[model samples]
Target: MTTLVRELWESGYMHTQDIAYIRPDGYIKITDRLKDVIKSGGEWISSLEIETILSLHPSVADVSVIGVRDKQWGERPLALVVLKPNAQETSADDIKAIAEKAVERGIIP
Candidate 1:
């Protein structure tokens, strides 16, 4: 575990939390977990954390996390959010900006 954490800390690549872990029974199971990390502009961004924050907004209904290409950032986090009906006055850029402030996650994206 130490090695895993150390590598994540150093490389800042896709996170294993969204990938897998060996079970105590030594078997693999399809467990519920956060999605993969997205790297943007040489920075590692946690899609899980961003999705969690986006879900906190009262207007938000459902959300999907994905990586989108950016000319300078390599890949950027693009939140595909479903808003509650009758909810108005919110924008995609708003969510993106707010998400950047919600968490550190051992990284600053």
Candidate 2:
């Protein structure tokens, strides 16, 4: 019980493992899980957000994002995607283009 208590408060806050942000309208929006967040160059990148964006592609049957070690950025996102069986024409570049567009639109960084 004591160990569990310590683990929960190890970060000085209760470890709910939830990542959330407060919008300008004063509403709190829960974004992702802390365990799934990628810490890169001092910025928090939500893996769930990336997966959600990638899943929007017509060819993407399923998608997941995970954090990988990076010497410079500390951590970087690695997307694992599964395309639709009939969408063989969809290339990796096509998937990347979607993410790039999201970046240009300030949707993800």
Candidate 3:
């Protein structure tokens, strides 16, 4: 029993409470972390999901997503992104378009 419990924790089920599932090919992929999720409008949003989508944009070099307080929704997602060296001139609308495309494709809600 002790060996089984230790193995479970070693398999990424402790501390940060990150969630993941094993693929049929025996690969572990993380879906989200409990402490990093954003709760907005009574819905739990995965910050990692948003970050992953945004990072796919050409201009984005790095990104972080967090929950910010909002009067109506209780909280909302806020993204902090670092642009690639040559992408310093990227506009907000351009960044938004990438996110919108992800939404349209049902990659994120």
What is the number of backbone collisions in each predicted candidate, taken in the order shown?
Answer: 1, 0, 0
TM-score of 3: 0.64
| Candidate 2 residue-wise lDDT, 3-87, digit = tens | 5456556768755456788899999887876587889999998888898999999999988676766778987887879999999
Off by over 4 Å in 3: 1-34
State the TM-score for model 2: 0.67
Model 2 stretches astray by more than 4 angstroms: 1-34
Model 1 residue pairs with clashes: 41-73
Please identify model 1 stretches exceeding 4 Å from their true place. Answer: 1-35, 103-108
Compute each candidate's TM-score over C-alphas. 0.57, 0.67, 0.64
User: What lDDT would each prediction earn against the true structure?
Assistant: 0.68, 0.82, 0.77
Worst 10 residues of 1 by lDDT: 10-19
Better of 1 and 2 by lDDT: 2
**Greater-TM-score candidate between 2 and 3:** 2
